[model samples]
Target chain A: MRLAAVLLFLATISAICHTDGYIEQVTQQIHLLRPRSGAAGYRLKDVDCLSWRLAVETNNVRNWKLVPEECEQYVGHYMLGKQYRKDCEIVAHSAIEYAKSLTLVGDGKDIWIFDIDETTLSNLPYYARSDVQFGALPYNDTKFNEWVAEGAAPPVPGSLRLYQTLLPLGFKIVFLTGTAERFKDIRISNLKAAGYYTWEQLILKGEADQGTSALVYKSKKRTELVDSGYRILGNLGDQWSDILGDNSGNRTFKVPDPMYYIS
Target chain B: MRLAAVLLFLATISAICHTDGYIEQVTQQIHLLRPRSGAAGYRLKDVDCLSWRLAVETNNVRNWKLVPEECEQYVGHYMLGKQYRKDCEIVAHSAIEYAKSLTLVGDGKDIWIFDIDETTLSNLPYYARSDVQFGALPYNDTKFNEWVAEGAAPPVPGSLRLYQTLLPLGFKIVFLTGTAERFKDIRISNLKAAGYYTWEQLILKGEADQGTSALVYKSKKRTELVDSGYRILGNLGDQWSDILGDNSGNRTFKVPDPMYYIS
Candidate 1:
């Protein structure tokens, strides 16, 4: 009975934790690693949402307009859930190990590319809003950009940790994003406020490249980067589009994101 | 008390089900869809194994020789668990949807590719053995080949369904496996026995490709298929090497396999 009581308390806290993960994340600067003190009650029976996420992560399902309507709560719970953080942590762990494995050239041409939105910062706070419905609701660029303009997005703990770790490892960082050039100021502030201090380049989508598909625009930018003599040693993103195109670095790591599909 | 008793009974059966999943799989010819008749208890605290699997599934971790020793039970439970089937089901769902959307050519040139082990045919019965340790043990070729020679593998229900679905949808089926040509006859018997009745081509690795890596060997084979005028519309595999590199199909579906990895 005591065990059940404790589990109930933990389950209650666990439920509340993921729902408000970003609040604690932004205000508290916590990593969202663990929700409570004990093993909480959760089941793998929510296989539908789990399946949707797996398909999204592996790029088997693309251009999904909205998450399955039935999976709104599941997606919310997952986005705010412990597993998402763990998935991101494993990716960070892999990136750190890979970054450490290389012998850096003294010339500082070795670079690591990071996709900005879900890779460097989490938009969970915005995505969890009543209007957003964890992306089951229609996407409004205006609403999203307003959230971006507010500069309240928190650093994705795993990615921020990777960013910090890469600084001392002799890999120059590049922040690549699909966010347009107009929001560059706000994005920079958001990044800095969220702990990203510097980068060799912050390439946002400029007007000149407007209307280009993410795959093509990103591919061209990467090609230009490679032609400029910077060797991309590692690339990290939440989208397959970030890591799939040419000049895709030596190795690519995908941080989990199921809130929305960009391509 | 009645609910608790029912739960306990279900739990017992669930435990027995996954441990002996392959036995039932091979003997019953039933899709391992649901494990039993109730809501079985499982906690998601096995985060490490879950994370390792996500990393593997997303191709973040590659070239792993064996499952992490700590994750043996977790991997076993996952591979034999309901989620594995559900994951594969989602992939198949996506493949079916994608295949339906495409306009197939009437020339018999439109084809779908399938990989053998852990893709079209499941090696779970062998991988779940005491010697295999659910892939925690170092791979033994002689032992694995012995299992393959028995010609007793089951079809991955999702892939088999996709194979069947594709055939009537006007898509030719092409089996492209890394298994050596010497085992071709056994593989054919295994495929036929497992419900894959006919295929446009069954390509096994020949002596000329013995020294090649899985990626290079598979790329060369796919190039040959393409050069011969086949347009690969869909390709399904359990390994990243199966769907990446030159001449990768128009779309690829990765079925869940955490037991072993091939680069």
Candidate 2:
């Protein structure tokens, strides 16, 4: 009986040790790597708060005040309109600052290429409206341009400050996107709504190039920029593709994208 | 200054939120998937205690009783050795009990596969000597087989009982390893030293033309087992690959490998 009891005890211990339930193992591995004080338990509380906020945003209640039309206008005016609205003014300023920052002494002129989606526009409101966190959806170009043309987009944080700083600096801004050129009217109208009027070029993927991978499309856009006699100063985007152009730029800055993938 | 302080305070809170990091993300994903957490964190105290004890045994100083030819054997025999001695006696008895419990099929042929490393012999002594937690250096096959033939492996908790029980119940035992066949003699010797001499086969990698990919090699091993006309009743290993046969299995039992990758 004593032996049996001992065996049972050993069995119990072994069961506890061996199971690969992932959480315990992961927690253990992390703890092994970085010992944390008891205070680390409070991290759960933070997680709870974040999860609650996300849940609230995604729920049936329209409490976050998602102004899609305003958002579009905000994106268009600042990204293109060159106006100095308090919230949406960064795009124009950064464009000018960036222009001056470039010293293209060689035969190649400098091009400032940008990514679409979160880089140029604020899309958290749209995510809030759709109640989706990471799901893929089609671009409603008509509605998007309509909103942009209205100049209703609230300025994205840190964007206008940089844009305003860049533009007066003498670098010609170029907008490159995977959005097909078939949506040129809406795209242009959207930028105009946001106050974007002129640029060296605003290149979008053609209709025949719709289903190709974003990397391939973006590479092609860089080639176009190069052909246009511009040495890329720096590419700015939320995604890796924008910054990964061949010999296009000397530096790359990535802004955080809290919502949506262009790919 | 007051406004700046407030802005800093808000920024601190926001930064804290972002730093919540990968743990929260993985936990949230797990919760969303709703997997059975069955027997996972169920025995946390025991798991912690066991891991702690192992750490102590590996680290303790006065425990050094053997040095020269048996320096390796000394650690294995005394620390893990004693544990195995206890396990073998218990498991031998339990194997009989387990054998009675099994309902043998009409085929009257059953096979038991054991994962090497932590599953059978004490591989920890090798790692313990080097104080390296990660990489396993290439095996010294001749030396390993000699050690194995010497019959000096410590028993993992609960393993002997299971192995013992299954043997008498008409189950043939085999040791299958991702370790190459060059070490087969040492491996066999090692098993014999541990009182596990009934192994019908010692299957190793690169022997029967199965390449190094974990998925492919394990599946190939299973094909050999099935072709031999024996039903795989239960598989024991320290990795997911050991039991998840070329993507099929009957019953799977796993042990923890705190040292290195078995797959």
Candidate 3:
């Protein structure tokens, strides 16, 4: 009996040691994975936040080329009015149903609003180079015009397919942006570069009232779109400011901006 | 016997279904996480084996800022360098180390090399803004030098610490860049703005080689460091080209460049 009891005690001690060791290993693993401590520290947080702060400060300074501030403004600066493309398409397709039910304007055709940068054309890649070089911010209007004339800005992902789908359904496309009036020629060139030829109207940022603030720039731009005599069925842009009328709307579609945006 | 056989049949069916479902789920998860299928989709087979052809062709065009050719060059532009304060603390340290190791030249502690963009100043934020408003490639030299002169460019993370660490060691500092030599006043102003009072040399791109390949341009510049009798112990810049020698002994350190490197 004594021998059996001694064996049990030894077994119990060994089991306890194993369990303690296992717990220690797991604790260490967790500690390592935790961001607030150890080798695998808050690396992502440091890089993302610091880089963003740096980008912002750099944009506000000397070489107009480092437009980090511009990127931040982009999210609020341009938005496709529809919350999602599918939602916008659905609402656009059903506009005829609504038109049949109401007195309607001159015609019951559909109109779509598109934000410029990430909608039919992408301009971020061109800007990314400027930040990298840090030499001098170049604004060669001739070169810009030439680039836009080339009409090589590829359609945003899923934009061409959807645009084609809507075109066949009697939907008229309208391009809108918070771009100042000075860039009219360049804007047209860029759209043409993207193989986009037949937009009904292009709405850009117009001069505002005496009290216009930077935040309201896009909102004012949207009011212009609303006044343009088109029953806005859907809106698309990368920024929230493009979609929301006063900036508020039902059907708003947005593409991701891995490169940059105003908001 | 009949009951046992029935039970076995049911168990087999259950096991087969479970195994099949498990296999399908695991396969789907695995596929979702792979590079070709991953969320970010940036997996390359190997750094060397993966050509920049796809990234260049797809991401670079006329509208994009950095051209395809430049993108291709960027992949192989990795180099090592370190940054120090203009106060000459780090230079002095390096000079002491050199004197201990080798025979004295003129002063045994004279020249220093500096990179322009991110090292001595900040330029990313300005680039970001131009990208949005301008929608063209970024380049604005006058403004770049102005920012430097303003000294608003924040020290790179940990750079100020390194600079403070190296001063008072007995070394004369020099600044060099691929910028034009004509901007000597601007460059000096920027350094002063950043708290760097004086430099033994302020070499610009034209002073080295006008329009040669960046790599070749950098190699020629290193000879000046040698000719100056300054035992180049540690060089500092954001890009690899700043510190890398054709064939020599210089301890190199790197500061991460999230914005992008021009050369």
Candidate 2's chain A scores what TM-score? Answer: 0.54
State the fnat of model 3: 0.00
Tens digits of per-residue lDDT for model 1 on B1-263? Answer: 58557547645743321223111111111111111221221123344887888898999886555465457678888888888999998898888888887888869999999988889999899988866767655556678788889999998968888888898999998999888889999999999999999989999988787756677888999999999999999999988889998888999889888887666
Provide the clashing-pair count of each candidate structure.
Answer: 0, 64, 70
lDDT of 1 by residue, A1-263 (tens): 58557557645744321222111211111111111211221122344877778888999877564565457678888889888888898899878877777889958899999988889988889888877767655555678777888998998859999999999888899998888888889889999999999999999988787756666788899999999999999999988888998989999999998776554
Model 3 per-residue lDDT tens digits across residues B85-197: 22122223322333334332446464445666666555544534532111123234455455444545544444444444444444556666666666667667766766666
B110, model 2: CA deviation in Å? Answer: 1.2
lDDT tens digits, residue span A129-174, model 2 = 4322121122344544454444344435556556555555655678
Badly placed stretches (over 4 Å) of model 1 are A1-47, B1-47
- The list of candidate 3 runs beyond 4 A from truth reads A1-263, B1-112, B130-152, B247-249
Interface RMSD of 3: 18.1
Give the per-residue lDDT of model 3 (tens digit) for A1-263. Answer: 58557547645643211111111121211001111111111112112322332222211111111223223223222222222233223322233232233332335335766777656676434433433211113233355445444545666645665566666566677777655565688678767666677777786655553233223655665566567555676666654345533643324554433233243
Maximum-DockQ candidate: 1
Clashes counted in candidate 2 amount to 64
Chain B TM-scores across candidates: 0.82, 0.55, 0.53
Say which candidate scores most in lDDT.
1
The single-chain TM-score for chain B of candidate 2 is: 0.55
* Interface Cα root-mean-square deviation for all models: 0.7, 24.8, 18.1
Instruction: Write candidate 2's Cα lDDT for B1-263 as tens digits.
Output: 58557547645643211111112211111001111221111111122222222221211111111121112223334334444344233333223433454678746557777776667766555445442212122223455445445545665665766777666666778777766666667667777666676767788776454334444577777887788787776666655456654523454554533233223
